[model samples]
Target: MDMSMVWRQWLTRHDRVRDALPAVPLIVIAVAATAVGNSAWHEPHWDKVVWTALSCVPLVVRSRWPLQVALFTLAGDLTLMTVVSHTSPTPAACLVAVYTLALLGDRRTAWIVGFVAAVTIAGVYSATHADSVVGGAGLVRFDFALGATVLGRTVRSRRDNLAAAKARAERAERTREEEARRRVTEERVRIARDLHDIVAHHITLVNAQAGVAHHLMRDNPEQAYQALAHIKDNSRAALDELRATVGLLRQPDDTPGSRAPVPRLSDLDNLADGFRASGLDVRVTRTGTPSPVASSTELTAYRIVQEALTNTHKHGSATRAAVVVDYGAKGLRVTVTDDGRPGVPKGAGTGHGLIGMHERAAAVGGTVSAGPRAEGGFQVVAELPISPRSRLTPA
Candidate 1:
């Protein structure tokens, strides 16, 4: 359709033509030199014609089998120089062969070929020419071979260096892809944990309130009204918290009221009050003056307490539960325990409740332990680091 598009299509369709193009110039030079040499001598013998054709044809296939091509070209040129007159195109073809040998072969092979070329030139000149002048001509031919060998070696080195650089670039790209995948997996796990905590706690309370309203609808109108009100309140609160958590996943420009404040340690008292309304006798106590902490650490402390209390309500079979917070110089420690019957087994739900708590605490450079208390019920204890030094340190 367009000129640029047509040009690209042509290039793609003619890849084989591009690969064979470089040899065309070398072929032309060899043929022209042979023709000129024949004209100068005023003779066209069969042996000279055959030798010129052989020397030039090998250049066409040089790239496909550089080593074999060089060997054949060199052998042909040597035979022609010995039998035919020295004014042939053998000298130029021999130079091209030496360059190919050095480029395709290793350093050791190049050195060996250089030695053989030098010896052959000197021997041929001494046999054909009868003076010191031939020695100078042999030296000039040897120099050409040496220069071709050096040029080929330089090109080979550059090609190797480029290949190594490309390999390194590819490896770095793979590593970056792996790192991106790992970060995405971690973010997904965090969102799952947050969603679970938000929905499970509030929905559980809503269910309890709905059941209360259903049973008292006919006999106790006022109590039923209050129960219905509690259900509405719990559901609304759950929606608010869910919105806050999910907003974190939205683009900054797409977020809906992303400025909503996240729950922190200061909100634990209100949290306990909500649970108390749901028939969980929740008590909270604190010791030591609370010190400043990172926002993430504060959020982790709050979630740990929240998950523990939700578990107690569902599985502990406890009438009373207590939350204790101890703020020390190094860190903040929070513990939740319930006085449930030891014989009552834990709930049959997935054990992700405890796992979520552990992951939250670990994310904030903390440790959490959750299990049945030796004396009576279940307990959860978590210690979260708060010092500035701990905040800057890697997990």
Candidate 2:
């Protein structure tokens, strides 16, 4: 708090100082010039002091009305010159006025103001003092050229640098907007994949149980009751997982420094059990001691296997399926294959299962391929990066 107070005080002092700059210099110059002029003439010094004090009035408005102040101050100097008749101290006044115009105005305008002040002052002095007229013109010309060229160039360079800085700021803002749009798009895609993985597999269970209940309803009422029970349990499980997945979107505090549940490799057993309960034969195998897989890769691998099994239960009457997990030097490789139904007995199913599996693999910077293998069964395979701490590389 003390530091903040000190900073505010410094800013206040700085503004006050800036407001007192060129105007202060002009007032100081006027008083000195008037004093010197009166001494040279042997005149009433107090009258000279009053005229010089009046000259200071123009300086107060120098920043807002620079050109006007310059002219007003010059008029006061001329009134002094009239009394002394050719013994005017107008050289000092003209130099300062020309500088005010050059520092505040554009290059072209500054040149015009400088030339007019320079030539007119020199001409008036020459007319009054015939012996040194040419030398006076030489000095006036040099002063005008330096103010118009050198000082004008400095102002132009500053303006150019300011414009370039504004352009760079605009470009950086545009890049930031584009990056935000891309993240939003990717997040929506991830949510869609999760929804599909959660509900699609459970739908397969519902269809199979409904079929069993219908076929044995009259002949085997006890078996039909078990099928209906299975259907109810499957539907509830699907609801719970769906709620868990989608609740992430509405949770208010899931930003930096927030806690949230994100599913990982440990959830695979629950997923396998859900399919097995739905009456499909499923076996899980592992090879080469497992290493930590990235969270994104782990979740993607689980979803891919779930979708592939759902396809088997939907499109094939296959009684058995295999889920193979392998760890290699470069990545984690997963494959789910089933000799669909042992002799086709059901209808075609959710045609997008393969597409969903493929998309899941791709989301984690991986690859997926699904098709009938040369050995006569359908196979779904995916490969993912193994860097446990990294999922997506920086764009």
Candidate 3:
């Protein structure tokens, strides 16, 4: 798009064009200087001008073969110096070659080549002209060569540092993106577990109530009406809870603080009454003095109880169930047991309900165990932390 950008792209694609362009100005300067200077024979030396121009020609491929180019340029400079018997044209071509070698070649090789070039140029210049070494001409040439090498090395180091910094920034960005995705997946799983527990519990009660109403439609009209009323109440409750659970997907700013409160340990009494209304004799008891706990822990405990009871209703022949809550210094423990004869086979329904319970407890740094008692009943016990210490990973 931009003219400068287009020029840069063209230069990058054409290596010879880029490299040869710089040498053009240096060649012009060297030839002009040599042609104008007075020679040892009191005339212009066209041979010195030719040699100087030839020395700068090798600079076109300095990047491709740095050491060989540097040596060739130095030899040209030496020949010109010997023929002129006076101060030679400023060795611009040799300086450029040494800079390229330092920038592209290894440090050890650059140092060795730079040292030899400097010593040979300085020694030859001092030998040719009287008092040139003492007059500082030799030292000036030596400094120019070494200074170009140092400048090239410094530029190379800066480019390397920039590349490394960019790489680190890219890696950090990728890590942040991965962490955000992981949190989103975890939130989705949590919502799914909540929906499973809510729908399964209330639907089971409604089904049982509908059956009772159907069986007693003619023989017991009054009880039939009562059973139908229970069904209506349960269906309404299910819808309310379902709406709340699904509302988690809404934008946070849409209806701040409008979502239903999460169920807590104190709500166990109402939960038990719902089971009682569904024809199950339910009892709830608390042992230690209840103390405040984390909201996550309370939610986990509630879900564990709800899932255990739902499984018992759907798969067990249990009519009597008990819920126990014990508050200890470290955490809260919940236990649910039912005295039901084995109604469904051992591996009855898809065991997702039990799995949900386990996941909920483990998320809050807790553990859950559910099994049939030796005395012919099913039991679920969960130990939840007051403040979650560490979350357990699910298998």
Q: What is the TM-score of each candidate against the true structure?
A: 0.83, 0.60, 0.86
28-74: candidate 2 lDDT, tens digit per residue = 65456545653373333556556555665565555567678667766
Error of 2 at 208 (Å): 2.4
What is the lDDT of every predicted structure here?
A: 0.76, 0.68, 0.83
Stretches of candidate 2 off by over 4 Å are 1-137, 252-269, 341-356, 388-395
> Which candidate would rank higher by TM-score, 2 or 3?
3
lDDT of 3 by residue, 130-243 (tens): 546535888988888888889878888888899899999999999999988987788888888888999999999999888899999999999999999988888887887777
Model 1: per-residue Cα lDDT over 1-395, one tens digit each: 89999977886677545434544565555455555653374334555666666676676666566677767777877777777755523355666767777887888988778667766765665566553424677667667777888888999899999999999999999999998898778888888888889888888787777777888999998988988888888887888888887777888688465535788888999888778777889999999888888888888888888888888887778989999999989999999999988777867879998999988877777899988877888989998889423322211
Best by TM-score: 3
Q: How big is the positional error of residue 62 in model 3, measured in Å on the Cα after superposition?
A: 3.1
Runs of candidate 3 with Cα error greater than 4 angstroms are 38-50, 83-87, 130-135, 218-221, 342-346, 390-395
Q: What is the Å distance of residue 349 in model 3 from its true position?
A: 3.9
Please give me the total number of clashing residue pairs in predicted model 2: 2
lDDT of 3 at 206: 91
